[model samples]
Target: MSFTCSDCGKGFTRSSSLQRHQSVHTGERPFTCSVCGKGFTRSSHLQAHQSIHTGQKPFTCSYCGKGFTGSTDLLAHQSVHTGEKPFSCSDCGKGFSRSFSLQRHQRVHTGERPFTCSMCGKGFTRSGSLQTHLRFHTGEWPFTCSDCGKRFTRSSDLLAHQLVHTGKMLFSCSDCGKGFTRSFSLQRHQSVHTGEKPFTCSVCGKGFARSSHLQTHQSVHTGGKLFTRSDCGKGFTGSTDLLTHKRVHTGETV
Candidate 1:
């Protein structure tokens, strides 16, 4: 007695579930936000969105004291404290706290790029990645640091930059007592002790500790100088190398 979606052939236990699922294929959004005029397929989605205008967050996380408009968001946030990853990737066996994160990670294995940039036509696995890529073309730096007035495209970059102003080294390496502003930096630093060169060049079979190093090394094989200086017409394999070379003209000390 299960109801099936005619559009996608998806089975649902209830007829109401099938009707709601049909909206995905039909592009039907019966519920509309009064404030922003945003369309939603479900009334619950509209109600959750209305919180943005009303500034109401009833659901609060007990672990972090973070407020969310919906219970589902709070439940997902709670996983951070519990360290529970309910969703697991079938291809890589990597666990993600959110199902959407798991879905995005699956694209790495499948090589599926659904989101494409309208200006450059560059494909991305996630919509957020495409949005960030579009920012480069638009020259939009939305996130700004309050202290130094430094601007960044993403909020995470801004947060990491803020650590520089505070002079806070939260992550430390156990191997050499080296401190890092970010956890990722600490992880990369720890690789030096382990001698782990995970990123390998397909052309030369040379391994690198970081992916950026491997990308730069690949340019040597292709004889491509992607980053070029305008003042001296000096070409470099990597952006960092070109940036370092620019200091000679600027007379800036590192």
Candidate 2:
């Protein structure tokens, strides 16, 4: 017998599955995390979240040696080694390793911004994006670097920053043999050989290999100096220009 959700009319194989589906409409989260007081619809989700507090990653990836608190996360990480993307978008034909990532990507085509910031009323495609946006209003930088004591709003930013202290260039260009701490940097470097400019400006129709370069180029049309020095109050179009200007004050020779 097929069980159906009353609210959404979604069919389920079992009554238990239907009950779980009802929680989405009811906004009911019975399981609560003791450490952070975060709520989850399922006990397994709560257990998975608890590992964040304990720092206990029992599930280790056989391919990369990376540890994950949950088996589902480990399965997702394994896709990186296998190059397997089971979840695919019907709209744009983009493949994703995880279902959650595919759902987030679908929002881009649908223009569905379900998650919204409470402070600024800005909409985001994913909850993680909303959480990161909320951090700016709350002045919360949860991720910290041990080497430099620098704080970042996102864990990915912290991970990228830590590579600077370690001098670890994990990503390398096949064309030029140049190394980069981030994969996007290597991708940008490869564009020099391929002559691919993916990021295009709406104003002047100028193409750039990197998004940062495109943003810097956009400032030329708007006449906006985004990066500013606190000491002299002088502004620059790009971060590299701002860093170069700082050397005048420090008297640093390069």
Tens digits of per-residue lDDT for model 1, 1-254: 99998865879999999998787555567998776455677899899978976879999998778899999888887886898999998876879888877976676556567666565454566555656656655657777789978778775678788888888887788888988877678878988899977667778789888755875787888887766676788888765687688789989766
lDDT of 1: 0.76
Task: Residues 105-183, candidate 2: write the lDDT tens digits.
Answer: 6765565666665654555665556666566546577777888788787766787888899889998888778889887
User: At residue 45, what lDDT does model 1 achieve?
Assistant: 84
Clashes counted in candidate 2 amount to: 0
Best by TM-score: 2
Error of 1 at 127 (Å): 6.6
Q: Give every collision pair in model 2.
A: none
Off by over 4 Å in 1: 1-60, 66-76, 106-144, 149-154, 169-180, 186-198, 249-253
Error of 2 at 188 (Å): 8.4
